[model samples]
Target: MLAKAFYPTEYKKQKENSWIRVCVRFLLLITLGVPSNTLGSFQITDDISKLSVLKQNIPRDYNISVSYVPKELAGMCWVKLNIYYLEESLNELAKKFGNVSSNKNDIKILIDMLQDMRLPLGHLDPIMYDFECHFRNEQWQTEQYFDYVKDLLKAAEDNISDDCDPPPCPTTLPTGKGFDVI
Candidate 1:
């Protein structure tokens, strides 16, 4: 038909170019987004600055620097996180996720992984927590958020591989969908 006749070669080239662009975009997001903000950078809970809770879950290594940027929290949210991690390079530890999966269950796997690392509370009954860590509405946009998660996973992965103290049980770890705990 028309596809096979006039534009066959041009059409094919166009398709190939489109595919290349998509891949480049994905890589760009994954590379730039993944390391600095997507996966490995450390993320203190959005509300970690809330006195008691911040004290409760202080990281063993890096300190969380809270910028009281109420005005620019929105204007500078993503940019700030990006710049912060860019300087620290904490994003180097994170694994960037591509487009979200259609499957809810797959999403659950990431949530489960977070719990196993003790970043989140044990998963059980209700999603609410006596104490829980949560992302701000804008957090998902930053590379730092995922990086924090990556750091915890890196620890748990090392722990499980080393047979050290038999990584905490799921219920004990308290992480999953619709659940939170301190």
Candidate 2:
């Protein structure tokens, strides 16, 4: 016990060819203990339309907006204001915006109701919104949307146009690529 404690083995006399093994062990230790690369977190952004769909919060995208319609005298007008609200689906979208049609369940009338819908700038019309939705969501169901839009256009041309009314440009509808148009 006394010899073991007093005459500890010296390092110079014990090992001969372990330098490579030592370096490999040190490198492996560093590779395992220390982080050599950083990892990135995944993220998904919430859009205004998705907010309406999710119904998680108040929709302020169209809050600070107003509409103006010139009266027959060209000097004054009484605008019928519309307050935008989120609906569950297309049926509800039509039911809530009933002023656009005599038939409440009419999808064509619902498309027309978009005219009353406004953006945060209050510069939107139904036709514009229709085009905006289509333009914005490239994956949107165009055939269904266009069927209603065409019907609304026909109704406007046949029953509403009085020569003094603004012409409907169904063909030149805006295709929004981003938030610029909506």
Steric collisions counted per model: 22, 3
**Which regions in candidate 1 have their CA more than 4 angstroms from the true location?**
1-104, 116-140, 160-182
lDDT of 2 by residue, 76-164 (tens): 10111111321113444344444745333344334334343322214435433433322222222323333333333333223322132
State which candidate has the highest lDDT: 1
**Model 2 alpha-carbon miss at residue 87, Å:** 29
Off by over 4 Å in 2: 5-10, 13-22, 30-33, 36-182
lDDT of each: 0.34, 0.31
Which residue pairs show backbone clashes in model 2? 114-126, 115-126, 135-176
For model 2, the run of ten residues with the poorest summed lDDT: 73-82
In model 1, the worst 10-residue window by lDDT is 128-137
Report the alpha-carbon TM-score of model 2 versus the true structure. Answer: 0.16
State model 1's lDDT: 0.34
Expressed as tens digits, the lDDT of each residue in 81-169 for candidate 1 is 22222223222222232345222233344453344333322332222121123212222223344354344344333332211121122
